[model samples]
Target: MVGLNRLSLIATLGAVSAQFQKPLLSQLDDVLLETDKTGDKPLVDTESLQAHISTESLFEHANALYELAKSSEQEFGHPTRVIGSEGHRRTLEYVAAKIDSLGDYYKSSTQAFPAVMGQVFQSRLVLGHSVPESASPMSLTPPTTGKEPVYGNLVLVDNEGCGASDYPDKLKGEIAFIKRGTCPFGTKSDFAGRAGAIAAVVFNSNPDGLSGTLGTPTPYHVPTFGLSGKDAEPIVEKLKAGEVVDSIAFIDSVVNTINTTNIIAQTVEGDQENCVMLGAHSDSVGEGPGINDDGSGSLTLLEVATHLTKFSVKNCVRFAWWAGEEEGLLGSDYYVASLPEEENKKIRLFMDYDMMGSPNFAYQVYNATNVANPTGSEQLRNLYVDWYESKGLNYTFIPFDGRSDYDAFIRNGIPGGGIATGAEGIKTEEEEAMFGGKAGDWYDPCYHQLCDDVGNVNATAWLVNTQLVAHSVATFAASFEGFPERETTKAAGVYEKDTLYHGRYLVR
Candidate 1:
């Protein structure tokens, strides 16, 4: 809406009206030509582009997405845009419609890929003759649907079951009992399966109820479930006393490969060889509307892209709405892996925006200080730092721990950085002092819950982060200037191979 009038004016006065006698939207080339002749603003300026960003515009998109999810719940079975659900399909259509309304200022396309998605229908865990206090199935775990409930003596694994030696010969034909720590639930499940265990159960390190993922589906993984530490304590005490503990673990689930699409758009006018890419996952976890977990990030990109159509750029700007990020960054991974080398080289930098409106917020910028970071990542980080300093805003750095959609970009030796408010991480006193939120509360108490609806977003945090998004995007779209070149040497962190992100939960 910001540049609609200007575009109409161009269509009315330009060749479309005078020569062809049509009301066609003026192309970027014509706009540039007109700018050159009239000595008007040509390349996109940061201030004007950013001025289009407003809390009203950002939340408008957010509310639309929320309403879409809520309305699709009866058909989809949940108020979610999860990868395979009808809600997700509608979400993609919404994005496509928005891009189409931009006329010909940009070229938009979509990529489809087959991805594995799992759903658990039922999970039950019983110790001895009674059930535990709480039992939740680990995501993507094998289900014991047709088979009898797994019946075996409990085999308490040694030392959290992170290594091969942790499971002894006694684990054979038994249920592995392990503690969660030092490794992923998948690793423990894998170890249990390799040790010939019938199934696996991992208790949380804390006293809270456990909800976890086994990373991705694997042949070596066994049916796994997470239990509260409080319930596991009594069982651990009985096992230590050499008391025989009989158990039954059952999970009814389905794992299927489904086709999903990722929306991609790029400005038709700019240096295609040095493109600046920005992305956010479009799909949410299967719990809620995800209005803040990533709806904030998605709408921020949408709002920015909407306003971006009003101007021209020197370097091409690309926007991606990735699908299936909740299932271990599947959409983004498929995208990066499918790119040809020449096309991949065209990307100058990739900026990821995942969560931007945490209820209890703190300004966070990715610090590409990990082994996977390429040469230019530090410069990108510095750009964000400089911007925050210029605005007199307090900010913090988060490690590139192979989380979020940036993992694929950084893994391929492309420099990347972006902003987030926060997620399940707790706010410290220092952050509270700067951001003015409760010191000990989770950044987003509604993270991955049914309550994460339109009301969960912190409007001030969302607006500020969106402003940063506009600034960085507009700046890069204009010129790369001193940005770093892509490095050919591939770097892989030691932990990168095993680390899987399930809504900020490390699933390694």
Candidate 2:
């Protein structure tokens, strides 16, 4: 990882250059005109456009679907696997319904009982208070019945404060106020519980409200809740003044099994010997409608698949809409791991799209090492960045972190890449000046919350990012070199030999 000083210096220089540029739409027009003059298809031909939807059209379709999802009270609470709740089944059914409506354009598949987990937040029975209108008990929170009025001083635990053997003892009987950092929420809660803390409160470290799963359930026992910084400020002040505080925590949340589906659409215009896979998870965390979490990517790919089938492309383009991603990439990991080795090797590239609609998000490129950069991955990133720069779009490059579905591919050395909009972190002063959001605010505050409904999407950002993804898919399908094949029997034999040697010598 690059040091903060270096990163800041680069960003400062980049920001200065980013300001003196033309509009992106104007640059797109120029590129389209040039491509047209070079004998490429015109951008606005009815027949051609119909044959393949433009990126803008795809964004519109995504917005429509997002609206459909948002308006359906039935579609709300479609939580899958995380808490094993009925909401999971509802989410599955909703996705399956969408795929079914697409007719023969898609094929459906499932991976059963994928290992999925998330954080827990319980209500202290004694501390049971009236439920806030906006907040609910976090999924996996333990059940409580006691109603004791627990009071203690609030202690702020930083990233380094967790996990010490004596640390929990220090906070015993006190209310531990922790910052969201380093470890998952589960770890912090577990630590507090072991130390005899009465209750726990967590707040977002950044300007944006803390969102996203904590990845696992904490084994230790305690009541927990996430509070916005605004809600926590007064509590922090009261603690400083040595004021004894009293509050109730009401947790009535339950967990059960729910069904969700993975939507797979295919275009078989060319030889089916090898396939190019493009995927994005369709499910969102229960907090919000997920218009941007994946609505942007899903809609873009849906439009791409819809149009590609109308053309005579040489390779197959399979679009997969996964489920249970917020529960730790469950759908894609299950699907990929279950595939036979022979079938797995047939995949050329896995293009994943998670978030591509945050107007304030920086444009990022995944830096994959060891494995060669496939035909259009690097080109796609550069093309989008250059396109953004030419049009003077304020964008930044974030280092690759395997936090999405792309992890499945990278683990197996399958070449892959995609795009994302910013999440729950503030844009710096430099970024704010270059971009258009407040410096202290996150790119999207509604991320993973109920506020992330259809209305939260940024249409312009959705349009441009979707177009970039569409363009990359189209170009890669037209010209991807085949992947090198590994002989299974020989590979297995080599593996066996290595294992035997290690067992015979290393173990002894």
Candidate 2: tens digits of C-alpha lDDT, residues 400-479? 45567765664554556776777775778888777566777778777777666556677766766666666666655554
Candidate with top TM-score is 1
lDDT of 1 by residue, 258-366 (tens): 9999999998888889899999999888888888878889899999999988777888999999998888788888998888778878888899999899989999988
> RMSD, each candidate, Å?
6.6, 15.7
Deviating ranges (above 4 Å) for candidate 1: 1-41, 76-78, 129-135, 145-148, 157-172, 179-184, 203-211, 227-242, 370-372, 489-503
Clash count per candidate: 1, 26
* TM-score, predicted candidate 1 vs. hidden true structure: 0.85
Which candidate leads in lDDT? Answer: 1
Instruction: Estimate the TM-score of every prediction.
Output: 0.85, 0.61
